[model samples]
Target: MRLLITGGAGYIGSVLTGMALEQGHAVTVLDDLSFQQDSLLSLAHHPRFDFLQGDARNPDVLGPSLEQADAVIPLAALVGAPACDVDPDRATSVNLDAIRTLLELRRPEQRVLFANTNSGYGSHPDAVCTEETPFAPISLYGRTKVEAEGLVLESGNGLAFRLATAFGASPRMRFDLLVNDFVEQAHREGVLVLFESGFQRNFIHVRDIARAFLFGLENFESMEGQTFNVGLSDANLTKLELAERIRRQVPRLKILESVTGRDPDKRDYLVSNDKIESLGWRPSYSLDDGIAELLKVCRLMPRRPYRNI
Candidate 1:
């Protein structure tokens, strides 16, 4: 398979790219290098790997990449609520506008696997969100992803994966994600002040996200023209519960709750991954598995800029 991955040098993208390469697929990566990290450097000598440094919003980049792609994975974006909130214009341009551009320009035969966020089901703590759940996005980031997801599904050749809050370590690591953030904080400060600690959310390992994309690609015939919630079934956890999990790995980590506190992202939803799991995909990494791995990395690289937003 020939795969074109936009923002393929990013945290999840880098992981996906490597996975695809290992699976004997030809991979092309298009990334703007906005984060200034050389996460893809290790793949420089791979025979099947190709990379183009560029922006997804630019037709000059998208046009040529789409031309060579058998499957297109649009991963480029100003990801997350905090990042999107900081620059709404750029967020809209990358997250929403670029997707519109892809839909308009992509060939009918080409397959598109879009990266959508579970954040779209905002603040639904009382219900478990599925692909059938109505989107109630609360942040600019989530809203943009929701709008983009609609475009992909309506385009017959496309498939959208509404991803849960991803939380495993990646080559291009991120500490902004809840699980990673809490674990890192506990390692560094030994204390954490949590707000909206009772908010529940779903999580998936980063590598599992990559696997879901591959699963969608391999089963594109049955999965096309649909949206699926991709997440770990056993990993639905509240913020307070997540902290407790982290504390188990990093002992003596004091957790302070603030009832008056608020989470700016405001994403609180328990998502079901049964829809995708039925298609023969399952997550291999558990919360404990990820934390154990992160703990080892923390000891090796104690202080690196791992947060994306």
Candidate 2:
């Protein structure tokens, strides 16, 4: 398969790029390199890997990239709620508009596998969200992804994966994610201040996200026009519960819950991964597995700006 991944030099993108190559797929990565230039450096010598440095929203960049693609994975976006809120315009353009561009330019037969966030479910604390659940996005990021996911599905040859909060270490590491942020804080400062500790959410390792994409690519015929929630079912936990999972690896870590404050990314929702699991796709790494890996990597690379805003 000739796979073109937008934002292929990104956190999850870099990981997925390598996985696709390992499976003998010819991979071309379209990334602006805004976050990091060297994220995909390790794959520089891989014969099947190709890198294009450009913004996904620009037709000059995206049009040429989409031409030879057998399948397209749109991972280019302003990822989190905080990042989107910080710059709504760029978020809308890249997250939503880029999908529109790809759909318009690509052949009708070219399969699209979209990276849709589960944050679109908003604050559904009382019930577990499946693919069929109504969307109630609270942030600019989630709303844009929700709209993009709809476009992809309506295209009739696209598959959307509503991924849970991704953890674990990546070639392009990120500390913005819940589990990654907490674990990094515990390791660096030895104490984590928690706001809205009772808020619940599901988690999947970053590597698992890449696996989900591969699963969809292999089963594209049956998976097209469907949305699947991808996450570890056992990892649906509260903030405090997530902290404890990290503390197991970092035993001296102290957790302080603040009663006066509210979380800016107050996405408290339990997600059901049954839809994806029914298709024989399951996450291989658990929260504990991710925490252990992150702790080791954090100590090895002690630096700032490892995260995207």
Candidate 3:
């Protein structure tokens, strides 16, 4: 398969690119390198892996790549609530409008697998969120993804993954994600401050997320036109619960709750991955596995007075 992955140098994309190449698929990454990350540099020498630098929103720039794609995975977007709030216009353009561009320009036979966030689901802690859940996204970031997801699903040739809060180390590392952030703090300072610690959320390893995409590509015919909630069934956890899990690895870590904590990303839900699991996709990495892996990565990172963020 010839895969064209937009924003393929990102945290998730870097892992997916290598996995696809290893699986014997030709992979082309389209990344702006907005973070100036050389995450795909190691893959440059691979015969099956190539990269192009451009914005996903530009039709002229995106047109040529669309022509050569057998499968299109759009991973380019403003990732979080804070990121979208920074520039609402660009967020809408990249997150929502880019889907429009792809559907307009691509051939009907070209399959699209969109990356959507589970944050788009309104807080339903007591209830399990499925793909059938109605979207009530509070933040601009969530709203854009929810809208983009609608476009992709309605297109009839696209599939969407409502990804859980991804956790784990990647070639292009990120410490901002919940598990990675908590594990890093625990390993480095031996302490962490919890916010909305009681709110439930699901998690999947970053490598598992990459694996899910690869699975989607292989099973596109049976799964296309369906939005699957991709997550670990056993990994739904609260912030406090996650910290406690990390504590098992870093025994000296201290957990403290804030008296005045109000989280802006109000995404609390116990997501069910049964739909995809019914199709035989199961996660290999557990929450403890990610915590242990991150503890090692934290030890390797250089320490400064401040965080990389």
**Using Cα atoms with residue i matched to residue i, what is each candidate's TM-score against the true structure?**
0.98, 0.98, 0.97
Off by over 4 Å in 2: none
Off by over 4 Å in 1: none
RMSD of each: 1.0, 1.1, 1.6
Looking at candidate 2, what is the lDDT of residue 132? 86
Cα lDDT of model 2 by residue, 62-116, tens digit: 9998888999998989888778888899999999998999899899989999998
Query: Model 2: which ten-residue window has the lowest total lDDT?
Result: 257-266
lDDT of 3 by residue, 1-309 (tens): 999999999999999999999999999998898888888989989999989999988999899988888999999987888778888898899889988998888888999999999989978878999888888898988999999888888877889999998888777788877888788788778899987889899999998999999999989999989999999899898989988888888889899998677656797888999999999999999998988888788777746221223
The per-model lDDT (C-alpha) reads 0.89, 0.89, 0.88
In model 3, which regions exceed 4 Å deviation? 304-309
lDDT tens readout by residue for model 1, 1-309: 999999999989999999999988899999999988899999999989999999999987899988978999999999898899899999999999999998888899999999999889888878988888898898899999999999988887999999988987788888888888888889989999988888998888899999999989899999989989988788898888989889888789999988786666688888898998888888989989998988877777788867766
